[model samples]
Target chain A: DAGITQSPRHKVTETGTPVTLRCHQTENHRYMYWYRQDPGHGLRLIHYSYGVKDTDKGEVSDGYSVSRSKTEDFLLTLESATSSQTSVYFCAIRPDRRNTEAFFGQGTRLTVV
Target chain B: AQSVAQPEDQVNVAEGNPLTVKCTYSVSGNPYLFWYVQYPNRGLQFLLKYITGDNLVKGSYGFEAEFNKSQTSFHLKKPSALVSDSALYFCAVRDIGIPGGYQKVTFGIGTKLQVIP
Candidate 1:
């Protein structure tokens, strides 16, 4: 459970339109990540934040942006939606300790028409 | 760069039979490996992890994984399969070898396990 929640569990937006997905966590973990899940490709990391206002790009960060202005929220933004951007997005958080595993939110399904 | 590979796309086993899902990893230094299972339309659930210590790590739901440093592998296994065990399994890795701080985790493409009745 890990006290994580992903808002807009399901969404559909027009191509070339702006979209944003939100991830909120109550555990107060220092690390949060955004990933997209696609068939065969598995989960691809889009971006991550190690601390409030500190962020970094991931393997599939192109065409996507993220902001973590506060410790509890990490936002993923699609500058201009594309059909290729349609997928199930997951948000994860892990403790600062090195030995522990990350906890995941339910997930957000976004479709770009 | 750290990476994980799940060589199988799918595996099937009859109920009560032993099952295994393979995973291998590449890291510049030491590694911290993990296994996760996902049911349809659900988020990933942690099964087990290989941090430090024993090579054979056990976790939730009758799952265990063997970590072999020489082969660069961490394969998940269960003694007996249950129909309820059918799901998508993911193997993930984090490179502790990376200096400075903890690195990001990389997950495998996933292996679908079908436990037939």
Candidate 2:
């Protein structure tokens, strides 16, 4: 509801293949984040971008990478997908202001075989 | 590192009964707390947040969370539960200070709330 959209609502891929998930926002927020949701892990941050070309690793960034070339789009890529990388991915955006709320995308369900 | 904990994995309540989902947080400084709800197959929806000011914060869908500094807790509450209220709830926290900026939020494992009809 916050002008956020995640492409490829559902995806299924085999192990060792490359996968990419895209998040688009219209709010022009300064902060964008990629997160993965597992059954017992809740949601863990994978990567975040403070601005275009400015990104940082999150708690769970081992198997994933992110790029934010423009203010509206942030992409997450899994170089060589594995079964353990299968999860629901979500994108979040927030303003630069401290303590501001973050908005989430609908989520992409990725299954690796 | 900032972290959040939702002690209960599942909570069951009858319709019209009061319901609560517990959450506790740990951080270096005063933490910014938040509650979010997620329906099956949907994204997380913002419920409420405790930035400053009043300890009692009211959020969407008749939900409220009380921020207790002494206990380091922010438990979500509802006066009467409804079948429609059944969903997964998550608690999150962010530290006030970080090198780059406001630290990224850390979410709990989530609590599944089931309101029986």
Report every candidate's CA lDDT. 0.94, 0.93
DockQ of each model against the real complex? 0.72, 0.78
lDDT of 2 by residue, B1-117 (tens): 788989999999999999999999999988899999999999999999999999999999999999999999999999999999999999999888665554778899999999999
Model 1 clashing residue pairs (backbone): none
In candidate 1, what are the lDDT values of residues B1-117, reduced to their tens digit? 788999999999999999999999999989999999999888999999999999999999999999999999999999999999999999999888776654778899999999999
Candidate 1 structure, TM-score to reference: 0.96
What is the alpha-carbon interface RMSD for each candidate?
Answer: 1.3, 1.2
DockQ of 2: 0.78
Error of 1 at B24 (Å): 1.2
- Mark the regions of model 1 whose C-alpha exceeds 4 Å error after superposition: none
Candidate 2 local lDDT, A1-113, one digit each (tens): 69999999999999999999999999999999999999989998999999999899988899898899999999999999999998999999987758787889999999999
